[model samples]
Target: MHSQNNDKKIIKKFNESESLVINEFDKSGIISFAQKDVSNSFLRGTSNDFIEESTLYWTMKFNKYANDFFKKLTSDKYNFNQGMLKVFKNDMYEENNSKNYLLINSADDIKEMTNCHLIPILKNIIHAPKEDMGLLAESLVHMTLLKRKFSIDQEETVGGAIVVVIISKSDGFIWKEKKQYYSNESNKHLEYVNYYKSQ
Candidate 1:
C-alpha cells in the first residue's frame, strides 16, 4: 500500500510539472505577440497610440488542438448538439439580472464586460491544459476586437473569435485586418478582426 501510494504521488507530481511547462509555452506565445510591433505607426507612437491607432493589433500562436476545439465550440453544430444556446441565454440573463445587458459593440463595452463579466465566464468555460494562459489570450483577443469596434453578437461566440485570431506556427508575425462573420449558422453576425495577417 505504501509503495502504491508513493507511485501515485510521483505520477501526480510529474503530470503537474508537464502541465506547468505547457502552460509556460502557451503564455510565451501571448507575450511574443504583445512584444512585437503591429505596424510602423505603432513603432513611432507610444503604447497608448498603438492601442488607439491599430485596427488589428497583434497575432499570437495557439495550440492547433485548442484552436480546432475553439472553432468547434462556435459551430452551429456544436451549439445545437450541446444545447449551448440555451446555456448562453441563461448566462446572459443571469449577468443582466441586476442591470441591463447590452451587446458588446465598442471598446468601452468590452472593458466593462471583461472587467465585470467575461473573465469569470472564460474561466468557467476554458478547462484544459494551460487554462489560465488560454483565458488571458482569449481575453486579450476579445479586448482587441471590441477596441476596434468589431461586433460580437453574443458572449458565447467569443471562443470562436479567439480561434479566428490564433496564429499558426508557419506564419511569422504579420499585420492585416478584415471583417469576420461567424460561419456557424447559429450566430451569423459581423465578426471583428484586429490583425488577421497571420491567418
Candidate 2:
C-alpha cells in the first residue's frame, strides 16, 4: 500500500522490462524431416505442429510418462519399462472434452511388439538447447535406424522420424516465417549445425 507515485514507478519499470521488437529484418524458419515407410520398426516419431498440439493438449497427462521415459534413457535411475507404445483412438481422456492419454506396458513385451512404438524423443527435443535441436533430431532418428540395422540411404522402411526446429527471436517476435522439409523420399537428411543454418 505504497503511494500512487511508487505504483507509477513500478509500472514504468515493468513496461521498460517488456521489450518486444520486430521489424522487416526478422525471420523465422522451421527445419524438420522424417524417414520413409513407418511400418518396419517398433518405433515412431512426429514433430512440428503434431508435437506442438500434443504438448499443449496433453500437458501433464502425457508429460509425466514422457518424463519417466526420459529419466530412464538419460539415467538408469528409474526402473521404468521401455516398451512399445500403443495409440488408442478413443476419447478416453475426456476431461472437458480433451482427448489425450497414454498407456505403458511391461519390459517383457518389448521384443514381440509389432506396432510402431512411440519413443520419448519428444521429451529430449523439448529439453534440448535451442542451438542443438536440428542435429539432435537427425542424430536421434539415425541412431534409431541404426538400432534396426536399417540403411541411412536405402530401404525406406516402416520406421520414420520427424523433427521440427523453428528459429526466431528469443523475445518472441516474428516478421517472416519459412519452412524447409527434408525426408528419405526426397533423399535429403535434416541436419543443421547451428540455429541460423536454415535462416
Candidate 1 structure quality by residue, lDDT tens digits, 87-186:
6645644553323222112223323432343234334433534435444555556654454455454333223434524333433222223233234354
Tell me the whole-model lDDT of each prediction, alpha carbons only. 0.35, 0.36
Q: For every model shown, what is its TM-score relative to the native structure?
A: 0.19, 0.21
Which consecutive 10 residues in model 2 have the weakest lDDT in total?
Answer: 99-108
| Per-residue lDDT over 1-199 for candidate 2, one digit per residue giving the tens place of the 0 to 100 score | 0122432343344323222212223332222234422211223333222332333344444545654555555455645444422122112223222311221111112212311233243344455765465555455566656645665565544355444344545513222222433343543333442245757
**lDDT of candidate 2?**
0.36
Give RMSD to native, each candidate: 26.6, 23.0
Q: Highest TM-score among the candidates is held by which one? A: 2
